[model samples]
Target chain A: MKNSWLALLLFVPYIALAIDTDKAFEDPEMQARYEEITAEVRCLKCQNQSIKDSNAFLASDLRREIRRLLEEGKSNDEIYDFLVARYGEFALYRPRMSGKTLVLWIAPALLLLLGGGVIVNIIRRRMNMPIEDDLQEPTNT
Target chain B: MSRFLLPLAAFVILIPIFMVGLTKDPSELPSPFIDELAPDFTLPSLKDPEKTVSSSDYAGQYALVNVWATWCVGCRQEHEFLMELSRSQSVPIYGINWRDGRSEALRWLQALGDPYVASGFDQDGRVGIDWGVYGAPETFLVNADGIVLHKHLGPLDATAWERDFVPKIGGGS
Candidate 1:
């Protein structure tokens, strides 16, 4: 069909955003921090995608907001606090240390101790076995 | 026999945990503003852009703040219920017309019944961002002290109104 060119216009918005996301941050370190922060924060509506990776309108809004905060000289911790204060801990890809999350944070150590206890119990039971039992021939008589 | 029993016990425990998770809507985020002061804002009124509405205007009164938009399908689905609820006069409802055209919102409200006492025109959605509004049709129940008591993330229906808002208000559904 000769009219297929009109279908390509649908991609204009994506092209616009491609140019927008590449606009540089003033300081290189700040840019690195910006990239890390965006990658770390979850897009609330699009739960699986980080803000850096999402094309959702809400994600774009968040990216703009995060940049504004960065420009205002807010630290990454302060930005996290700001997001968590409004959106709750769900926005954080990595949860903070808190009473509610204590079990999650300590689970690995608990599992390690449990595994060690099982191993020690098995070794203790084996320690009493005779080492010379197989050395002698069987007496059929 | 002991090894089989240990895993059986773990399986029994996991059943209840998984069942509880099944009933929850994973898309719903836990409301962080519950028992906290409702975030403050003053935006142009949706009905008349020249006049502004502020969160403080609803202070000293129990109110419902609804986030909506002409572009949101959920908002359209919930509009009829909102109109009916407005007729009942149980509580005053405020609105945030988020990231939507002021003209289109006004036209929609005019064509449909106006449920919100004062709707804020959140043209750029900055106020919505401040309120942690990730989705449209989120509702907040605020007490007379201006503390946000509950947040309903999806469209309001009779079931949620009875289950969530009624218990908080201590009223018979």
Candidate 2:
């Protein structure tokens, strides 16, 4: 009974590690393209998960669509265009810079600059102030 | 006072943005096909595979193209409203029976009330991808020019129909 329990625990991990290979292409290059696209495409059903990681029906359908597009000799940009044309820019995990997304792309750098300005200002102000030796406790002299 | 200026301005700016975002539905994804020509497709009619259904059928009139499946609970919830719309005859309701077993879909229409003028059997949901259908119970409004005007995700109710669809079609319905 103890051996069976140990075997069951081992079996659980194997099931979790099982790779989904049903939608793979015959060509290695095409399969790599398939993997790349699926990983980058956001599953609409589960907004945070990539299509490659999601088990949603919509994700599976998108995988099938990617396979078909690859088989049709579509380039990466063309495939992205196809998805964006239908589902909008939100479908892509890495969104391209556009009019609406200009701020989103630059916000992090902008925030860093602002933070750096504040730090510099504080440091400069501190340098200008005289040190107060009386504020510190007298050491055992 | 100077130290607080940046945060105060950010608060002022972000307040309205957050308020606007809160009012919007996260699940309601905006489709890119709006005001563009609807994707053209020729599919087999769900009821009788011998007959064909095409996008051109909606030309010369405004129509509702609803994507549904037997497995979608939202589709079932909105079914009565669809049947009611069909009976009123203001606009024809077409269906894309997406990614569903044919027999089960046929039985659903029979059991509930058949609202669609013709439901296209999209066996593998390939056509659905063209329509930007991520989930069931999505309704597209196509104008007489065959341009897709609006896409409504989730079950259609009287409130949604009046608020969204009615104005676009010009309040007569």
Candidate 3:
């Protein structure tokens, strides 16, 4: 009887500790979605840090809000819509490729093509010219 | 000719090993949570008036740093875990108290516990902002190299310490 009571005494606190463990592992689907949205959201306080990377109170609250929303069965689009309505489009880490963002999306490719064209044109001009004749013509002139 | 063939064969055989090593698991990339260097700042130490501490203060140690404010209830909820972790590991624990009254912070540390080696008082939270801290009770595991190796967004607990952190870093459970 004493041994059983001793085991019970030891086991009770451990069992209580184990009860709290579920908080860390609870709602796998919700947790995964929480991660996705946090990654997508930008932290306003930190320069260019995603909510996932920030440890600020606002970021933490936002993350908890996301988790709560997910637990309430809100879809990713719905969560994003809620955030956009509150914080505007700047809340997203990857700004959408829309009309206003078209420049942001296209400018790099356009610049690359322009640069390549200039280089190719210069190379072709150099190749087409007769170097020896060009030098001789300049000297003759 | 034989030497060249052997070298070529060795190169061919080693390619797969090299590729496997280079293509590490995405999950293992040190969650953007605490992958970067912890931001540097010298804040007044809560315990000592004249002394100041910064990220460089823990340069040669494997430190678990927690950011919390006395006003934050979540920090209180995670208090036991911090105490447990401190007791369990030889690693040092440091705290950055963000935007809280200095007296309350000191009182809380005195009442609940003081697992922290030193606590920084970030009165304005500018240092917290620089560290990318959005909330209270965010914890970072910084390697000896001063690179943040892992981050726990919410409260810390035994299960998280074992499953997520210890296994990832090959530390004792």
**Candidate maximizing TM-score:** 2
Native contacts conserved, per model: 0.77, 0.85, 0.08
Arranged by TM-score with the best first, the candidates are 2, 1, 3
Query: What's the lDDT for residue B168 in model 2?
Result: 90
lDDT of 3 at B118: 88
The local lDDT score (0 to 100) that residue B119 gets in candidate 3 is 90
CAPRI quality band, candidate 1: medium
Count steric clashes of candidate 2: 0
Winner on lDDT (1 vs 3): 1
B33-77: candidate 3 lDDT, tens digit per residue: 355666677899988858987778888778888998888888988
Candidate 2 DockQ, CA atoms: 0.76
Off by over 4 Å in 3: A1-141, B1-33, B171-173
lDDT string for model 2 (A1-141, tens) is 999998888766544443345645778888888889989999998999998998888888888888788889999999999999889999999888999778989999999999999899989999988887567777779
- Give the per-residue Cα lDDT of candidate 3 at B163: 78
Writing each residue's lDDT as its tens digit, candidate 3 over A62-90 gives 67667667878889999887666444456
Stretches of candidate 1 above 4 Å error? A1-22, A123-141, B171-173
Question: Given the true complex, what DockQ would model 1 score?
Answer: 0.70
Per-candidate count of clashing residue pairs (backbone under 3 Å): 0, 0, 9
